[model samples]
Target: MPTEYVKRVLAACVITVLSISNTANGLAGDTKEYRIGLTSVIFADGTAFVNDWRTYLTHHLQAPVKFVQRQTYREVTDLLLAGDLDAAWLCGYLYLQHRDELELLNVPLFKGKPLYHSYLIVPSSDTKTRKLTDLKKKVFAYSDPDSHSGYRYPQLSLISAGIEPKHFFAKTFFTWSHRDVVNAVADGVAQGGAVDSYVWETLAEKDPQLSRRTRVVSKSPEYGFPPLVTQRGLAQRRADNLREALMHMSSDDMGSKVLQILNLDGFTVGNDDLYNNIADSIRIVEQGG
Candidate 1:
């Protein structure tokens, strides 16, 4: 063969091999699923909403997205710690417990802020109850044991008021879902409940009947909203990509719709300081301060 003809053949063969290698790598990346664990406390009331949000994330991340949900925060936390999940949306109290093991990705914004509060709620019929102290010896419902808004804040609030948290309520139970906490109180199963203010406001907006049946006795001081987090040791590049997807979600049309369903304004690269108050509450609960 002529010299130029031989060189052309070699060049074509080289291009073919490079193309094959790139295609294989792309397939590998596409097949790797990013699992995200979501606790029930963060559950949006509608399943359709979750599915849409998952689809949006999958598109933006350019990978399959799996949302793993469990009955309790601890179950999801365990899965995340064991590497069953790549990331999770967890209660701040749970995040604080495993802060060293988890990487904070971003915090969802509610009403344009990275902060939310714990709401002390009671049946609308109970007008006499003014605060946690006033509910002494009354039954109480908590959304989850590991919940910052649903459990820890109430515990800390009672402790701060010089009341024995353990003995203050005649009975206490876990409703598991913030919506259920509202339901439990509305149905008179419990005289009062601690719930995420974000959940409460969302419910109040979409289902006025439920919100009308219950009343907010008080709202706890603002705490960092429950956050999206990844494994502590996830590759920096992968983590950054996931973080970028979330923080920029609001800019996408589908992403913005999902945020509306979630009753959130958007997301931001929240700071460690937003959760400092929660860490303090956790320490007090553990150390009996």
Candidate 2:
């Protein structure tokens, strides 16, 4: 069962499923409406930012921007696959998992690069613990099952160290939000956790008191940042327009403000090579490389 707090948050989210019959005739001209899915992770712990981003995008594109929110990344991906959404910003892991079904659009530039890391963290008071092995038999919090940083990287670490992830941790739980994973560690609900570095760093900048309660034990090698993607069959011109709007955001005042709120430098025309590391990791973990 979800906590009452999560229930409240979920209730406020917007998720509209529209059919082709409802949008096809109206999407091409000046009134083009773009329905985009924002993965749960990108909600980034701020309603104000999400609202501002929607307003900016809607104005920039001269169209209605519908942000579809789901509680999980998988749900957002499903919306893309089902043709209910025009495009979505999803985790890199999901990109590789369904590479053939989704087409990459744009990748956000963070600190001038299109890359981020997985953070391994523990409560600040656990100074004696230094690495993954030190957390053996302790409780752990994971962000999401479909998240590479939150779920896959930690499991990969365990396997590389020759430890069984299932038996090594005394207990584990999924917080469904990377921000919540940090909260779980800081609050001592979990002694250790795996979280997205970008999310943690953003929180560290915006809320030092909370960030100070947890210490980063290690960071995974850099991986491509999460990216915007359209389904394989989306119209080329439609995808191109959305991609152009994102890549040009830094030059526009309102778009610049939205970037500041999200703490992203800008968006880039990132290529598949950016996610090669992730694809390689998938092979190593799945094929016993």
Q: Compose the digit string of candidate 2's lDDT tens values, residues 219-262.
A: 99999999999998988877888899898889988889888878
Collision count for each candidate, in order: 0, 0
lDDT for every model? Answer: 0.88, 0.87
Which residue pairs collide in model 2, if any?
Answer: none
lDDT of 2: 0.87
Residue 157, candidate 2: alpha-carbon lDDT: 86
Error of 2 at 61 (Å): 1.8
What lDDT tens digits, residue by residue, belong to model 1 across residues 165-265?
A: 89889999998889999999999999999999999999899888998999999999999999988889876766777888888778999999998888888
Q: What lDDT does model 1 reach?
A: 0.88
The model with the greatest lDDT is 1
Ten-residue stretch with the least lDDT total in model 1: 25-34
